[model samples]
Target: MTSYNKVNGKWTAENDYLLNEVLKKKWGFKGFVVSDWGAAHSTAGSAQAGLDLEMPFGEYYNDSLINKALQTGEIKEELIDDKIRRLLRVRFEAGMFGPQEKQTEGIFHSNLHKQIAYEAAVNGIVLLKNESELLPIDTGKVRKIAVIGPNAAFARIGGGGSSKVTPHYSVSPMEGLKNKLGNSVEISYALGAIIKNDVRIIENSFFENYNGKKGLKAQYFGNINCEGEPSYTRTDTEVNYLWYYDAPYWDFHGADDSNYFSVRWTGKIKAPKSGKYKFQVMHNDGARLTINGNVLINLWKDRRKSEIDEAVIYLEKGQVYDIQLDYYNNGGVSEIKLGWEIPDTDLIKEATELAKKSDLAILCIGLSDHFEGEGRDREFLILENQDKLIKEVVKANSNTIVVIISGTPPILETWVDEVPAIVQAWFAGQEGGNAIADILLGNRNPSGKLPCTFYKSQNDSPGFSDYQNDDLQSKYVEGIYVGYRYLDKHKIEARFPFGHGLSYSKFVYGKPQYALNENNKAEVKFTLTNTGISAGAEVAQLYIKPLNSQVERPEKELKAYKKVYLRSGESKEVIFELNQDDFKYYDTNIHDWQIDKSQFQLLIGSSSQDIRQTTTPKSL
Candidate 1:
């Protein structure tokens, strides 16, 4: 047995040993366990338990270690054979070590795949605000359209990490509009603000190969000075490097010796504009930055944690400048970030000029992969500098349509009121541009509803400060009061309630009807009618509320939803069934799910806040 270590005020053992009793035996898990990178700290204990494989590279599951364990009888021979059999079984089932299949040409970028992608993008677009029917732009009357903002030309198809995929081609919002409008409409584009501070070496066109190679050249030294010849040299594909829980894979030494090491990265960056650019470096321990043989930032000392250091420098447009970064890690966690913000004085000027001349300004600005992605949390809930850009663009042209391209609901109190229209365009895939254009041009009716509550600010959330804890202890103190439930229970109003969306056509709902079914389940029925001129889809939401219950519960919980398409003056009936699981709540005293024999309220509406009809139904 291995000794335990104290972490977060609790004694923690290696998961390789803990998982055997918990997952394999207690839970009856037949699947083998694969250890995370560098997670297997022991040889005998881990193998004696249920650990089948060590990922990436095996430090403990080698031949010598297993032989020693087998000779000492710490790990039985059957365990080793069983692990190998499981590995081979999984490999055979996955077809990895089986008969190979031939690849088909053009299958990767087939037309059918592209059409599905386009359909998904258009269907997911949610129309949040359309004041006075400002959308459905008149193509005959509108000749000039100014596509303004940093995201106007930027094609954010997906986020970072594993989700980052290089599509065959991506259509930017500007391109989509142009392709849809054709030669009839003249479109102008302007980057309203420098949304992305710096581009990555692997992705961005602004970064060139440092040593006439593909990526930035990195030289690693064992000592702190980075003197003489480097112990190892490699090319780093990305500049945004973070090595906290684990260290980088190097040949010279093991990860345990990562405490005292130095690295220097040399790269070249091309400036897109001629202005003062802000260079920033976020790092733990010590880091230094230099550009064009000049030391821009020097924070080469041990920092308690991670800190950001920034400096400003003027550069010429189209000229590639030499960039270098020196980083050293001295124990604990390690992280280094190298990025720069482009000068923005000319950005506002260009946007205003384009907006004044155009008939309408389409400001495509919102969060991107840099702000929201895997393993990264947003620092601020509000979209930075977007309010200023919106105000400036709206001032120049009152006929402005603000489109927010983000995965989650962004804070919109700053300039939401000033704009005539707002659209929530989530990280639409390869055909996002065409979908957005279709919605703006009225080629497609927006019907997507908000899945989560859109709060005015981060402070409005019930668990805002308690989201992440450092002590490894998290409590769902809010319980059933999450998202819209929290707002509804506390009588707190959100910027936009959950299940809220707008269509070109108006929808009216009839009184909700409910009854107990033969299966002892509750069935809710309602009718919806499109009372407007255009054909659209309406999402009828059904929420369950307890009229009287012994246990504490939320004001209402959304149980089921149905989206129905209706032509002008068309009506349709929606039916949803709720089972025993829907009415049952966890009873602490009984230690099981329980349902109180009481009257329940059934709600039907377009949104959580816009309940049109409610009726109390008797339970079976």
Candidate 2:
């Protein structure tokens, strides 16, 4: 599918050089191309450029528009038939034109699929730091385990936007530990910090309707502005709703159109404590809040992105206040949530105290979709208030394990040295909690490797301004010097190098043997032995360094890699076949890939910085 971004200053959907010249002709992609949602710009332009389909109901690629374009000679009828032919060819190759198979019941969400998810989550977890081999917590020695931090109670299944998934069942980190250790070990939990800026949803007990009922009265309108009569009226236990692709009252009245809608909720709120309260509303389009006839927040304007607006007001205990909220959805992905933060509490102190009394502390802290996700970019990589939380928890309980839950790497320079063990558990799937438990309890040896370099700070890499121009253009000034290449070129050390991951068991590599085969392919062979007592998997990476070249190149470039699992005292011979294409570099001057007859240094290792064997081989 064509992406939402542009290539060479032209929209991908309408770029003929990219779609027709490069994708279709040069690469020989026979399948028809589809544009992303709302990505199509012009019917004639996109159709001529090889865009065969427009996603989620077309605005420009409609039948009327296409027919108009063809009639006006802007697009040819032959091109339209070719697009349909490609699509039909793909369907025919998949046997769709043949016999129809009977649909199988209970195929989806089966036990086999669950097992695959569990294995994927287990293998994708990377072990970053294991000081003193403190992980694989000895359940017999540690009686009480304190699970602290914001992400401990809930399972962070995945990031937001299209990546989010709804599993049949999910297990939180706290629940996983209990399920693993059972009653043999006492487990405690405490919220160390509030990572999300928005507060929790207001409880149902705190609200009352006009009839003294236990929920707020909601009135829904079909238009953006609340006008005339209400289309629907209902009682909502809480003012939290994420109507992603459906309008309000979709389930009850089948109003699937989410383009324009508004809702107003009215109730009375009573504070449990007399203190300053911070009220917040997380919405996509527009929202307003009022209490006792005073408008606290009035953001009644169309918003293209999701945002959080807040206000602080003092409320008295035992006194009831009239509360009202108005929300409107201008377009896509509707969401509105009313929440508040009460008086401040010493959460860090409480967590530290619990850690001090426990035998061991497992701190679950990291970024979620709230901090980084689609349509949002984090201002900084360091987790907010989590560095301090880690520092304090480690000081209280020396035996602490830091489990990080994020889709990307986070800066850990502040408290990384103080922590004994650290696990980088990327947004695991439905069985994420159980997978993390497996790694922590030594049921599985971590074999996951970092796909990119982790810099110590943002300054260690190229400045963001270097890549973004004032004319709203992205500049690849670093060229091929990205990730580990940039670090290697600048002689800067990484916090953790690319492809770096630690395992419970260790492996040793023998000297590599290189030879050219009859087909002129470089054949490299080596033996890997599991020296440690425990069984584990090792990801062997092959890198090539140009010993002689006319153009400048990075220190090394990864060509191929393989993951080999070995038992204790077991050895296996690994082979890798490489052709001349693997050593060729893209030459912009010639507008093609070019290879030089030069001797290249072949380095085999577990990580980019940990090469174990080296051999010199000439380019095939």
The TM-score measured for candidate 2 stands at: 0.83
Report how far residue 521 has shifted in candidate 2, in Å.
1.9
Give the C-alpha miss distance for residue 484 in model 2, angstroms.
Answer: 1.2
Predicted candidate 2 versus true structure: per-residue lDDT over 1-620, tens digit per residue: 99888888889999998899988999999999999888988899999998999987789988899889989999998999999999998999899999989866765568888899989999999999998999889887999999998778667777767655556567778878888889999999887787766445675778866555688999888777877677878788787665555565533332336558889999899998899999989898889999999999999998877678989999998899999999999877777888887776577897999999999999999877677667656654777677889999999999999999888888899988899999999888778889999899998999999997778888776545374467767777778887788888899888889999999999999999999878879989999999988899999999998888778888898988999999999999999899888888888897789985667899999989889999985444
Candidate 2: which pairs clash? Answer: none
lDDT of 1 by residue, 521-547 (tens): 788888889999989999998888888
The top-ranked prediction according to TM-score is 2
Q: What is the C-alpha lDDT of each candidate?
A: 0.78, 0.85
